[model samples]
Target: MASLLFYMSATVLFAQSTVAFNCSINPIYVDIHKRAVHGTDIFQYGSFIGVGTPAQNQSLWPSLSQNITSFASLSYCTNNSTTLKECTKSTGGFFDASTSDTFRELEDFNTLDNDRNGTFDGAYGRDNMHLYTHYFETDGASETRLTDVTIEIAQKGDIAPSIVGIGRESTVLDALYAQGLITGKTYALYIGHGFDRAKGAVNGSNVFGGYDSGRFTGEVHKYPMSPDTKNPMTVRVKDIIINDAAVPNGEVSLFDQAAFPDMKSTPTPFQAEITTDQYPLALPYQITQNFIKHLDAQKDNYWGDNSLKLKSQFNGSLSIVLDDGFTVTLPSEVLSNWSNITPIQDRDENSTSPNYLSTAFLGQIYLMADYEDHSFYLAEAVQKNNMVMPVSWCPKTGAPQAYQRPQQNAWIKQGLIGAVVGGILGGIGISVCAYCFIVAYLRKREEKKIEKDLERSKAAKIEQMEIEEAPEFEGPPKTPKTATPFFWKKRRS
Candidate 1:
């Protein structure tokens, strides 16, 4: 059971169903096991089914059930566009409400089910995991959307603070390996450090409070009455899976981008865009945009199209949030020209690819999806424009919708190279076969012709002999003299 559960969790943890046709083998499912390690010494865990979507105030996600269904119905293609079914209840994008206290950070996440209990487990061990579907997309009431999608990830692990990380440092991998227990074992990975305040980005409603140190004090400790300010569990996931779903389609174009309040600045690379009600990093501030200029990364906060529509421009006041929970804002004229990024590739290229960037410079990037309100990516950290988790994104501009093979002069040239090679091979094969057949046929025919010619010559020679003998026999004199000897008696008489 444990092994099965673990496999299931791993499958969901890293899922990408939008690429493959098989619903069972999707990579979009994010299954997390929020287990508690028995006590402070150990941990316990639980299983969860989740859509690979991020949550925040005023944030939205696609209908997990609907999208999954629609994906299942479609014939899977590496180059195709998939439209999610309308949320019958909402009949629109899934606008997920902020699970995080973006608008109001609880003095104690303890009351907030802090122990990674998933459900109200432990002190509030109701042992229940919450299920939510929130999405927000602007369609003509109902319209098709184009976002790269496929499969789902299912995975299981102690997605909690079980094996305490000995220390804090980026370069401590070697040291941790030195500690056989730490290196040999594995763990789940969680991002976000607690803060005192939480609130929104527009006015300020995004913030949370917790100890600066990575410890789960609020939920895991014996003290329930205390706030949920415990350090976080550093989890290292075991497996990751994704389905490639980069269909061939024309991409969305960009028109304009502007922040309501024009600020004198450029789109900072690796910058964080925060939006909270009243707290630290709530307002859109220009931190460094760590994302690179031409590389693929998560939450790459650039002034590109947020609305995933063809010929549409991203006009929302959307900002980028970082993994550490920072945000980056866009000025009206900060971003222009959408040729920086290529078309959206398959899921694996966006997720597990070595070039895949880390967490968005901001906590999460803000982009647009079709029927889906917002799509998010939990990219790696320290990636310059590398790691990004967009609240939503589409290939409206810089990001293309399909892989672009270089333009050729004509259709014939499209696969000219391959065709040429194939033609050469075919010609050789035909020539060899024809040569052998013709050689055999000619050899037989030559023998028959030679026989006929020899017969004709022999007939001519025999005819000549008969004609020459007839001419010698034509003279009559030689026959009588020899015969007279027999009549000597008559002559004497």
Candidate 2:
């Protein structure tokens, strides 16, 4: 029999400021060799979370569910823009709300007003749904469950269906905080590679109020979270160093066109968000091309369909310099997905449209997010053969202090040669630096404007539903796409 771990009282003096509980990261199934009939990638991956009675008995929507057991991420009813059957069918999961005694309906709000009519669409087409469970648990340990233990359904949009709603305002996390189920609004993530284990199971880690230090090497590199609450995990990258060369040069443009035509080079000092939902780190084509060339990596095409991929048998590291003078270096093992060539169709059945397949997964990157103080920390991962639970983070202060390193100053000092600089150096040197900064700023600004324009233009078209109208299925209804529905929303970028 499994034992339940109760929450600690407020008066209890924890050894650490943050609390960490082992997470259950279930690997959904995928067929990497054959493409789906819906023009999706040959393979797709999603995480599994417990819902309904007997926790592990049912999986979440958009995940790989077997035995006809799973909960719908989005819910809906008759007379909606998308039929209930259509919504559930699209996600490739099995869900039946009518039979479950614990089923509860709520509003459905998707990533965007997918349809440009100034209205919102439910998950795929289904509205929000929740169920009661004896607290959430992964493996054997009990997880922090929100009120009603609800799970929002999402059948349509840019996000992967297998994700847990861990965003700043996600009702699930909010409820946990309101109920005093956690020490603070903090969490850590360690997404293990899917192909690493002999059984081919994912062993990723997620802890709600603290982190497990055993998952990372060296020390944590603390940085201020982005002030933009909408994009809290944003990181301002100063430059991308491949191996040892700062790429984006005219020479690297050759490989840029190999993946797609006119692959623009990404300028330095740009912003990127850390998204666990994606597998690849999203980089501009030009940078990707440079990454390919320097690493001697080749594009994969198992079916000879001119598939875009990053392939390399060699080893290398990609370093990201932040504006705050911190550096994050990722090993080739963490960045390479060459062996896995799953490509998801992003828009309008145009197989080559930009999508999650393009973004690089933060594999082996350990992350610590403190939502209460609006800060997060990151570190290079160190994989362990066995799980080790350290003492829970306990701090006497109101908020846990950030990590400090004695070598950080040395690293920044060496980086002063050409990296992020914001001071008055020798007269001529300062003048040249100022000139370069101005040019880079203007170029980055132009790119931002272009990206925004493209996003708006694409949002309308990509929001269209491909489901058959009045489709009949032996299951619950679809989430209503009404003019006004209040529910959870997240920015995936």
lDDT of 1 at 166: 12
| Model 2 regions lying over 4 Å from their true place | 1-48, 53-93, 107-145, 155-159, 195-202, 227-230, 244-266, 292-313, 324-326, 334-361, 390-493
lDDT by residue for model 1 (23-77), tens: 1211111111222211122211211111122321111111111111111111211
Write model 2 residue lDDT over 229-313, tens digit each, in one string: 3345777666665553344441222232443355454344556666543334545445545555555555554523223345434
Query: After aligning candidate 2 to the native by TM-score, how far in Å is the CA of 96 from where it should be?
Result: 2.7
TM-score of candidate 2 to 2 decimals: 0.50
| lDDT of every predicted structure (CA atoms) | 0.23, 0.43
What TM-score fits each model? Answer: 0.24, 0.50
After the best TM-score superposition of candidate 2, give how far the Cα of residue 252 lies from its true spot, in angstroms: 11
